[model samples]
Target: MNRYAVIDIGGKQLRVEPGRFYDVRHFTSLQEISRSDVNIKVSINRVLLICHGSEISIGQPWLNDAVVKGRLLHPCFGKKIVIQKIHSKKKKRRSFGYREQLTRFVVDSICLNGRDLKDS
Candidate 1:
Protein backbone atom coordinates (compact mmCIF):
# COMPACT_ATOMS: atom_id res chain seq x y z
CA MET A 1 0.00 0.00 0.00
CA ASN A 2 1.19 3.47 -0.88
CA ARG A 3 0.89 6.25 1.62
CA TYR A 4 0.91 9.92 0.70
CA ALA A 5 -0.35 13.27 1.86
CA VAL A 6 -1.20 16.71 0.59
CA ILE A 7 0.33 19.58 2.47
CA ASP A 8 0.25 23.36 2.34
CA ILE A 9 3.47 25.36 2.28
CA GLY A 10 3.83 29.07 1.55
CA GLY A 11 0.21 29.18 0.40
CA LYS A 12 0.91 26.46 -2.14
CA GLN A 13 -0.40 22.91 -2.04
CA LEU A 14 1.87 19.97 -2.75
CA ARG A 15 1.36 16.24 -2.91
CA VAL A 16 4.15 14.49 -1.05
CA GLU A 17 5.30 10.93 -0.45
CA PRO A 18 7.70 9.42 1.99
CA GLY A 19 11.41 9.19 1.06
CA ARG A 20 11.01 11.56 -1.86
CA PHE A 21 12.52 15.01 -2.24
CA TYR A 22 10.59 18.07 -3.29
CA ASP A 23 11.65 21.60 -4.18
CA VAL A 24 9.48 24.26 -2.62
CA ARG A 25 9.64 27.97 -2.07
CA HIS A 26 11.88 28.87 0.82
CA PHE A 27 10.13 29.80 4.03
CA THR A 28 11.23 31.77 7.09
CA SER A 29 11.16 28.76 9.37
CA LEU A 30 13.78 26.94 7.29
CA GLN A 31 16.05 29.91 6.63
CA GLU A 32 18.20 29.61 9.74
CA ILE A 33 18.26 25.80 9.58
CA SER A 34 19.49 25.68 6.01
CA ARG A 35 22.54 27.80 6.75
CA SER A 36 24.13 24.99 8.76
CA ASP A 37 25.49 21.73 7.32
CA VAL A 38 23.53 19.43 9.57
CA ASN A 39 20.43 17.43 8.79
CA ILE A 40 17.55 19.01 10.65
CA LYS A 41 14.16 17.43 11.05
CA VAL A 42 11.32 19.72 10.03
CA SER A 43 7.67 19.15 10.82
CA ILE A 44 4.75 20.54 8.82
CA ASN A 45 1.29 20.47 10.36
CA ARG A 46 -0.76 21.91 7.54
CA VAL A 47 -1.91 18.64 6.15
CA LEU A 48 -5.05 18.84 4.09
CA LEU A 49 -5.48 15.22 3.09
CA ILE A 50 -3.90 11.84 3.58
CA CYS A 51 -4.18 8.53 1.76
CA HIS A 52 -3.08 5.20 3.10
CA GLY A 53 -3.87 2.19 0.93
CA SER A 54 -7.67 1.97 0.87
CA GLU A 55 -8.21 4.31 3.78
CA ILE A 56 -8.36 8.01 3.11
CA SER A 57 -8.77 11.01 5.34
CA ILE A 58 -9.76 14.52 4.37
CA GLY A 59 -9.72 17.61 6.52
CA GLN A 60 -12.04 20.54 6.67
CA PRO A 61 -9.36 23.10 5.80
CA TRP A 62 -6.70 21.25 7.76
CA LEU A 63 -6.25 18.24 9.98
CA ASN A 64 -5.14 19.20 13.44
CA ASP A 65 -4.02 15.66 14.22
CA ALA A 66 -1.93 15.09 11.12
CA VAL A 67 1.72 16.05 10.64
CA VAL A 68 4.42 15.43 8.08
CA LYS A 69 8.05 15.18 9.04
CA GLY A 70 10.93 15.85 6.68
CA ARG A 71 14.60 16.71 6.48
CA LEU A 72 16.04 19.98 5.25
CA LEU A 73 18.45 19.07 2.51
CA HIS A 74 19.63 22.38 1.06
CA PRO A 75 18.72 25.72 -0.41
CA CYS A 76 18.81 26.25 -4.12
CA PHE A 77 17.44 28.37 -6.93
CA GLY A 78 14.69 27.47 -9.34
CA LYS A 79 14.68 27.86 -13.13
CA LYS A 80 15.20 31.37 -14.32
CA ILE A 81 12.20 33.22 -15.73
CA VAL A 82 12.64 36.08 -18.15
CA ILE A 83 10.38 39.08 -18.54
CA GLN A 84 10.48 41.56 -21.38
CA LYS A 85 8.69 44.72 -22.39
CA ILE A 86 9.02 46.38 -25.77
CA HIS A 87 7.63 49.42 -27.52
CA SER A 88 7.95 49.23 -31.30
CA LYS A 89 7.27 52.87 -32.10
CA LYS A 90 9.39 54.24 -29.27
CA LYS A 91 12.27 51.81 -29.93
CA LYS A 92 12.47 50.94 -26.25
CA ARG A 93 12.90 47.52 -24.81
CA ARG A 94 13.46 46.12 -21.34
CA SER A 95 14.25 42.59 -20.29
CA PHE A 96 15.16 40.90 -17.06
CA GLY A 97 15.39 37.42 -15.63
CA TYR A 98 15.44 36.00 -12.16
CA ARG A 99 15.22 32.68 -10.34
CA GLU A 100 13.16 31.87 -7.31
CA GLN A 101 14.88 30.80 -4.14
CA LEU A 102 13.82 27.29 -3.16
CA THR A 103 14.60 24.69 -0.61
CA ARG A 104 14.96 20.91 -0.87
CA PHE A 105 12.82 18.89 1.52
CA VAL A 106 12.79 15.13 1.88
CA VAL A 107 9.76 13.52 3.46
CA ASP A 108 10.74 11.07 6.19
CA SER A 109 7.38 10.09 7.61
CA ILE A 110 3.70 10.86 7.81
CA CYS A 111 1.89 10.67 11.12
CA LEU A 112 -1.82 10.56 11.67
CA ASN A 113 -3.72 9.94 14.88
CA GLY A 114 -0.55 8.90 16.70
CA ARG A 115 0.37 6.32 14.04
CA ASP A 116 3.40 6.93 11.90
CA LEU A 117 3.93 5.77 8.33
CA LYS A 118 7.60 5.74 7.45
CA ASP A 119 9.36 5.41 4.17
CA SER A 120 10.24 1.90 3.03
Candidate 2:
Protein backbone atom coordinates (compact mmCIF):
# COMPACT_ATOMS: atom_id res chain seq x y z
CA MET A 1 0.00 0.00 0.00
CA ASN A 2 1.03 3.61 -0.57
CA ARG A 3 0.67 6.67 1.64
CA TYR A 4 -0.03 10.29 0.83
CA ALA A 5 0.05 13.73 2.42
CA VAL A 6 -2.60 16.42 2.73
CA ILE A 7 -1.94 20.01 1.65
CA ASP A 8 -4.09 23.09 1.86
CA ILE A 9 -4.22 25.47 -1.09
CA GLY A 10 -6.75 27.95 -2.45
CA GLY A 11 -9.02 27.27 0.52
CA LYS A 12 -9.12 23.52 -0.22
CA GLN A 13 -7.36 20.38 0.90
CA LEU A 14 -5.40 18.28 -1.58
CA ARG A 15 -4.26 14.69 -1.26
CA VAL A 16 -0.67 14.56 -2.49
CA GLU A 17 0.99 11.33 -3.49
CA PRO A 18 4.29 10.42 -5.09
CA GLY A 19 4.33 10.11 -8.90
CA ARG A 20 0.89 11.74 -9.09
CA PHE A 21 -0.48 15.05 -10.24
CA TYR A 22 -3.22 17.27 -8.82
CA ASP A 23 -4.99 20.29 -10.31
CA VAL A 24 -5.85 23.02 -7.85
CA ARG A 25 -8.48 25.68 -8.38
CA HIS A 26 -7.31 29.14 -9.26
CA PHE A 27 -8.04 31.83 -6.72
CA THR A 28 -7.85 34.65 -9.21
CA SER A 29 -8.54 34.84 -12.92
CA LEU A 30 -5.96 35.81 -15.49
CA GLN A 31 -7.71 38.97 -16.56
CA GLU A 32 -8.27 40.07 -13.00
CA ILE A 33 -4.70 39.47 -11.92
CA SER A 34 -3.17 40.90 -15.05
CA ARG A 35 -5.21 44.09 -15.23
CA SER A 36 -4.98 45.13 -11.62
CA ASP A 37 -3.83 48.70 -11.10
CA VAL A 38 -1.99 47.72 -7.97
CA ASN A 39 1.27 45.90 -8.55
CA ILE A 40 1.28 42.44 -7.08
CA LYS A 41 3.33 39.33 -7.57
CA VAL A 42 1.48 36.06 -7.92
CA SER A 43 3.35 33.49 -5.89
CA ILE A 44 2.47 30.22 -7.54
CA ASN A 45 5.76 28.50 -7.20
CA ARG A 46 5.70 25.77 -4.53
CA VAL A 47 3.47 24.17 -1.91
CA LEU A 48 3.99 22.53 1.48
CA LEU A 49 3.29 18.81 1.91
CA ILE A 50 2.92 17.06 5.22
CA CYS A 51 1.89 13.53 6.09
CA HIS A 52 0.59 11.78 9.18
CA GLY A 53 3.96 11.18 10.78
CA SER A 54 6.40 13.66 9.20
CA GLU A 55 6.52 16.90 7.23
CA ILE A 56 8.23 17.81 3.98
CA SER A 57 9.76 21.20 3.23
CA ILE A 58 9.52 22.39 -0.34
CA GLY A 59 13.01 23.88 -0.62
CA GLN A 60 15.02 21.02 0.81
CA PRO A 61 14.46 17.33 0.03
CA TRP A 62 12.95 15.85 3.14
CA LEU A 63 10.23 13.24 3.51
CA ASN A 64 8.66 11.45 6.40
CA ASP A 65 6.35 8.46 6.59
CA ALA A 66 3.76 10.29 4.54
CA VAL A 67 5.71 12.83 2.57
CA VAL A 68 5.41 13.92 -1.07
CA LYS A 69 6.97 16.48 -3.43
CA GLY A 70 5.55 18.49 -6.28
CA ARG A 71 6.39 21.36 -8.65
CA LEU A 72 4.35 23.93 -10.51
CA LEU A 73 4.23 22.89 -14.15
CA HIS A 74 2.37 25.72 -15.89
CA PRO A 75 -0.73 27.84 -15.94
CA CYS A 76 -3.57 26.30 -17.94
CA PHE A 77 -6.38 28.14 -19.63
CA GLY A 78 -10.07 27.68 -19.02
CA LYS A 79 -12.98 27.71 -21.48
CA LYS A 80 -13.49 30.60 -23.79
CA ILE A 81 -15.89 33.26 -22.59
CA VAL A 82 -17.38 36.14 -24.44
CA ILE A 83 -18.90 39.38 -23.18
CA GLN A 84 -21.18 41.45 -25.36
CA LYS A 85 -22.69 44.88 -25.02
CA ILE A 86 -25.35 46.33 -27.26
CA HIS A 87 -27.24 49.61 -27.43
CA SER A 88 -30.68 49.59 -28.97
CA LYS A 89 -30.91 53.34 -29.62
CA LYS A 90 -27.48 53.77 -31.24
CA LYS A 91 -27.28 50.26 -32.69
CA LYS A 92 -23.81 49.81 -31.27
CA ARG A 93 -22.29 46.54 -30.08
CA ARG A 94 -19.12 45.47 -28.33
CA SER A 95 -17.68 42.03 -27.68
CA PHE A 96 -14.88 40.63 -25.60
CA GLY A 97 -13.32 37.22 -24.93
CA TYR A 98 -11.59 35.82 -21.93
CA ARG A 99 -10.18 32.63 -20.43
CA GLU A 100 -9.46 31.63 -16.83
CA GLN A 101 -6.06 30.63 -15.55
CA LEU A 102 -5.41 27.19 -14.13
CA THR A 103 -2.23 25.67 -12.73
CA ARG A 104 -0.62 22.21 -13.11
CA PHE A 105 1.83 20.33 -10.93
CA VAL A 106 3.76 17.04 -10.89
CA VAL A 107 4.72 15.03 -7.83
CA ASP A 108 8.46 14.35 -7.68
CA SER A 109 8.78 11.86 -4.82
CA ILE A 110 8.56 11.39 -1.06
CA CYS A 111 12.07 11.13 0.24
CA LEU A 112 13.97 11.43 3.54
CA ASN A 113 17.69 11.36 4.02
CA GLY A 114 18.05 10.93 0.28
CA ARG A 115 15.83 7.88 0.22
CA ASP A 116 12.29 7.13 -0.79
CA LEU A 117 9.81 7.13 2.06
CA LYS A 118 8.00 3.90 1.40
CA ASP A 119 4.98 2.86 3.37
CA SER A 120 5.88 1.32 6.67
Candidate 3:
Protein backbone atom coordinates (compact mmCIF):
# COMPACT_ATOMS: atom_id res chain seq x y z
CA MET A 1 0.00 0.00 0.00
CA ASN A 2 1.12 3.55 -0.68
CA ARG A 3 1.53 6.11 2.06
CA TYR A 4 -0.82 9.05 2.15
CA ALA A 5 -1.99 11.98 4.28
CA VAL A 6 -5.09 13.99 4.98
CA ILE A 7 -4.48 17.72 5.06
CA ASP A 8 -6.62 20.79 5.53
CA ILE A 9 -6.25 23.89 3.36
CA GLY A 10 -8.53 26.89 3.23
CA GLY A 11 -11.02 25.00 5.44
CA LYS A 12 -11.20 22.17 2.92
CA GLN A 13 -9.85 18.70 3.65
CA LEU A 14 -8.01 16.78 0.96
CA ARG A 15 -6.50 13.33 0.66
CA VAL A 16 -3.01 13.65 -0.82
CA GLU A 17 -0.42 11.15 -1.87
CA PRO A 18 3.17 11.74 -2.82
CA GLY A 19 4.22 12.01 -6.47
CA ARG A 20 0.70 12.95 -7.51
CA PHE A 21 -0.60 16.33 -8.65
CA TYR A 22 -3.73 17.96 -7.27
CA ASP A 23 -5.71 21.03 -8.20
CA VAL A 24 -6.58 23.05 -5.12
CA ARG A 25 -8.18 26.38 -4.37
CA HIS A 26 -6.11 29.30 -5.54
CA PHE A 27 -4.23 31.70 -3.32
CA THR A 28 -3.69 35.16 -4.76
CA SER A 29 -0.23 35.55 -3.29
CA LEU A 30 0.86 32.21 -4.70
CA GLN A 31 0.59 33.57 -8.21
CA GLU A 32 2.86 36.48 -7.39
CA ILE A 33 5.51 34.20 -5.96
CA SER A 34 5.30 31.77 -8.85
CA ARG A 35 5.71 34.52 -11.39
CA SER A 36 9.26 35.16 -10.28
CA ASP A 37 10.07 31.53 -9.70
CA VAL A 38 8.76 28.72 -11.79
CA ASN A 39 8.69 26.28 -8.92
CA ILE A 40 8.61 26.86 -5.19
CA LYS A 41 8.51 24.72 -2.12
CA VAL A 42 5.29 24.76 -0.13
CA SER A 43 5.14 23.56 3.45
CA ILE A 44 1.75 22.85 4.94
CA ASN A 45 1.52 22.58 8.71
CA ARG A 46 -2.14 21.68 8.79
CA VAL A 47 -1.62 17.98 8.43
CA LEU A 48 -4.52 16.21 10.14
CA LEU A 49 -3.20 12.71 9.70
CA ILE A 50 -0.20 10.93 8.28
CA CYS A 51 0.12 7.29 7.27
CA HIS A 52 3.61 6.15 6.52
CA GLY A 53 4.39 2.48 6.08
CA SER A 54 3.04 0.89 9.25
CA GLU A 55 3.25 4.10 11.29
CA ILE A 56 0.25 6.30 11.80
CA SER A 57 -0.11 9.58 13.70
CA ILE A 58 -3.23 11.58 14.35
CA GLY A 59 -3.38 15.07 15.74
CA GLN A 60 -5.84 16.73 18.04
CA PRO A 61 -5.99 19.56 15.55
CA TRP A 62 -2.57 19.52 14.07
CA LEU A 63 0.59 17.67 14.96
CA ASN A 64 3.54 19.56 16.32
CA ASP A 65 6.66 19.88 14.15
CA ALA A 66 4.94 18.04 11.34
CA VAL A 67 4.58 19.35 7.80
CA VAL A 68 3.92 18.34 4.21
CA LYS A 69 6.18 19.64 1.46
CA GLY A 70 5.01 20.23 -2.09
CA ARG A 71 6.08 21.84 -5.34
CA LEU A 72 3.93 24.47 -6.98
CA LEU A 73 2.93 23.37 -10.46
CA HIS A 74 1.29 26.66 -11.51
CA PRO A 75 -2.16 28.21 -11.43
CA CYS A 76 -5.02 27.63 -13.80
CA PHE A 77 -8.77 27.79 -14.06
CA GLY A 78 -10.86 24.67 -13.77
CA LYS A 79 -13.78 23.67 -15.99
CA LYS A 80 -16.62 26.11 -16.23
CA ILE A 81 -20.13 25.68 -14.91
CA VAL A 82 -22.91 27.36 -16.80
CA ILE A 83 -26.15 28.94 -15.58
CA GLN A 84 -29.14 29.94 -17.63
CA LYS A 85 -32.24 32.00 -17.11
CA ILE A 86 -35.37 32.39 -19.21
CA HIS A 87 -38.25 34.84 -19.32
CA SER A 88 -41.47 33.25 -20.45
CA LYS A 89 -43.33 36.48 -21.33
CA LYS A 90 -40.49 38.02 -23.34
CA LYS A 91 -39.18 34.75 -24.67
CA LYS A 92 -35.70 35.83 -23.77
CA ARG A 93 -32.88 33.73 -22.38
CA ARG A 94 -29.52 34.40 -20.87
CA SER A 95 -26.60 32.20 -20.04
CA PHE A 96 -23.38 32.69 -18.15
CA GLY A 97 -20.62 30.56 -16.73
CA TYR A 98 -17.92 30.59 -14.12
CA ARG A 99 -14.63 28.83 -13.65
CA GLU A 100 -12.72 28.49 -10.43
CA GLN A 101 -9.03 29.21 -10.46
CA LEU A 102 -6.90 26.50 -8.89
CA THR A 103 -3.33 26.00 -7.96
CA ARG A 104 -1.61 22.78 -8.91
CA PHE A 105 0.70 21.03 -6.50
CA VAL A 106 2.62 17.82 -6.23
CA VAL A 107 2.93 16.49 -2.71
CA ASP A 108 6.66 16.04 -2.23
CA SER A 109 6.95 14.57 1.23
CA ILE A 110 5.18 14.10 4.51
CA CYS A 111 7.38 14.74 7.49
CA LEU A 112 6.78 13.20 10.89
CA ASN A 113 8.78 12.05 13.89
CA GLY A 114 11.61 14.42 13.00
CA ARG A 115 12.47 12.51 9.84
CA ASP A 116 11.88 13.10 6.16
CA LEU A 117 11.38 10.68 3.30
CA LYS A 118 11.15 11.79 -0.30
CA ASP A 119 8.25 10.47 -2.31
CA SER A 120 9.13 7.90 -4.90
Candidate with top lDDT is 1
Q: Which candidate is the best by TM-score?
A: 1
Q: Where does the lowest 10-residue lDDT sum fall in candidate 2?
A: 36-45
Count of clashing residue pairs in every prediction: 0, 0, 0
Candidate 2, which segments miss by more than 4 Å at Cα?
26-67, 79-98, 111-116
Steric clash pairs (candidate 1): none
The clash tally of candidate 3 reads 0
- TM-score, one value per model: 0.91, 0.44, 0.82
Instruction: Write candidate 1's Cα lDDT for 1-120 as tens digits.
Output: 789999999889999999899999956575454466656789999999999987899999999899999988888789999999999999999999999988888999999998897544
Q: For model 3, how does the per-residue alpha-carbon lDDT over 11-96 read when each residue is reduced to its tens digit?
A: 79898998898998855345454445656778888889988777788989988878889888787689998999999999999999
Candidate 1 vs. true structure, TM-score: 0.91
> What are the lDDT figures for the candidates, one per model?
0.87, 0.55, 0.81
Name the lDDT value of residue 98 in candidate 1: 99
The collision pairs in model 3 are none
**Which portions of model 3 miss their true places by more than 4 Å?**
28-36, 87-92, 117-120
**Candidate 2 lDDT tens digits, 39-77:** 222332223454434643442322233334556555567
Which candidate do you rate higher for lDDT, 1 or 3? 1
